[model samples]
Target chain A: MSRHLLALRQATIGDASESIAAVLDQLAREDPVGAQWLRSLDWAELRRLAAERALAQAAKTLACPLQKQYANASQYGTESGDPPKGTCIGVLVGGDTGYGSSVQLGVAIDGQALSFFWNVASQEAASGTLERMRETVRQAFREQTRILMLELLSEDGEVQREQDAAGRTVLRATLVVGGGAR
Target chain B: MTTKGTITIIAIPKSAEVEVHIDLPEVPECTRIAARMQAVLACLGAPLEDIQDLPAPRQRQGVSHAMRKRVRGGT
Candidate 1:
């Protein structure tokens, strides 16, 4: 069975507001045609253009079938219980700040099945825990376990917990793969 | 008056994959922008299946807090 993990690094814009302004300015100075095009857009038109760019960027980054499979599996739901064994790939993205900062991870083993987890937390703790989650994925890649499990861990090596709430860190780890082993 | 805010788009990749988050000025503007974004996603070959509006950080905290309480209360 083949298992793969594709990690898309966070974009390096420090502040979205500032970055957008700067990018627009740069476009205007360096590419007058593009700047003029942008300037001609209504507010709604500009937003549509932005959305198109973001989608195109993500699509380019996830060109591989495995990555696409994993992404599909992560977002959709499947029947309850373990997935039939075969080749399974999981894709997860997590971070403390920005849009969709809540911890969301999805694994797709078979073609149509998906298992997902969402955890909401304070910004400070969410950021730290997301780093640990990435490490966990790396470890899973190294170990090649048939079943993968991960816990949100703090910097000090203890299981992480939401600061303002009473609950242990939640990590629901299960992989589903349909069809015969590959 | 023109309303101003940010919008984030997350692509979900099934038949098509895109999620949108809007913080625009007015409801009408938000609706118009969202429809336009959907069109863009379609042109990009990944139409949107779901769209979500992300709340501001402070509002998110409140929602999360409430959710945690509900979970704890076993509702």
Candidate 2:
């Protein structure tokens, strides 16, 4: 399993309005310790805390389950000097498929089976065609995970295709989030 | 709007392997995120062979909380 960090830099989450208060009250009812930890923060910090639960869901969905032990003791500031807040999560990036090591995590689309990517050389495909394919995959993936990635769609993002020596391909997405520190 | 950060998500053959940024910009709706995650899992074809409600966690000896929320991890 590989580890990835979801870093946040002074993103504004707004004031502790009544709605947010209600949410915190509910959180307290469920997890008082967490609520206490969250309540101490201003809206900016609260917004950062919100990522905690969301990330847990994300990690769980990826089969690379989120472990609290991996959480950094983010009590210090960093080079960016903005608290350097981040959550380290274990990611299952590669695995053995018997024939050899494969990054094909065995996922399907629209409940349809996918052909082995190694058999189809991405280099042979036309540049535009490959880009289209990659876009199609990205769209399908976004459509499938719209809920978890709700806010990310609005941000300009890019997708790249990565292939190892074994021709194993991994589609990587980099989504930039606009700061909402209102 | 200023760019605050970037989330790197990897998508594998499993259409659902895509990593979510979960960068809390404004709203951090836990229920919404959980619902979406559950949907993503279903989309990934996680076998749903069984449907049993999780048992309530046992209360700690002297703790005053019951932790009634059914969330898998209160992270």
The global C-alpha lDDT for each of the candidates, from Candidate 1 onward, is 0.29, 0.31
Instruction: Tell me the RMSD of model 1 versus the true structure.
Output: 21.6
Instruction: Output the lDDT of residue A95, model 1.
Output: 49
Q: In candidate 2, which residue pairs clash?
A: A12-A181, A107-B14
Chain A TM-score vs. truth, each candidate: 0.21, 0.21
Most DockQ-accurate candidate: 2
lDDT of 2 by residue, B24-62 (tens): 333333223333333322322221112233343334433
Residue by residue across A1-182, what tens digits does model 2's lDDT show? 32222232222111112344555566566555445644554533223233333334443444443333322223321123122233221211222233221221111111121211211122322324323333333333333333233332324435444664644443334333334521
Largest lDDT belongs to which candidate? Answer: 2
lDDT of 1 by residue, A1-182 (tens): 22222222232100122223344455455444434443443433322233323323333343312122223223223322222332223334444355343343333222211122323234524246545553343222211110110110011223221222332222222111112200
Candidate 1's DockQ: 0.02
- Model 1: what TM-score? 0.22
Residues forming the 10-long window of minimal summed lDDT in candidate 1 chain A = A145-154
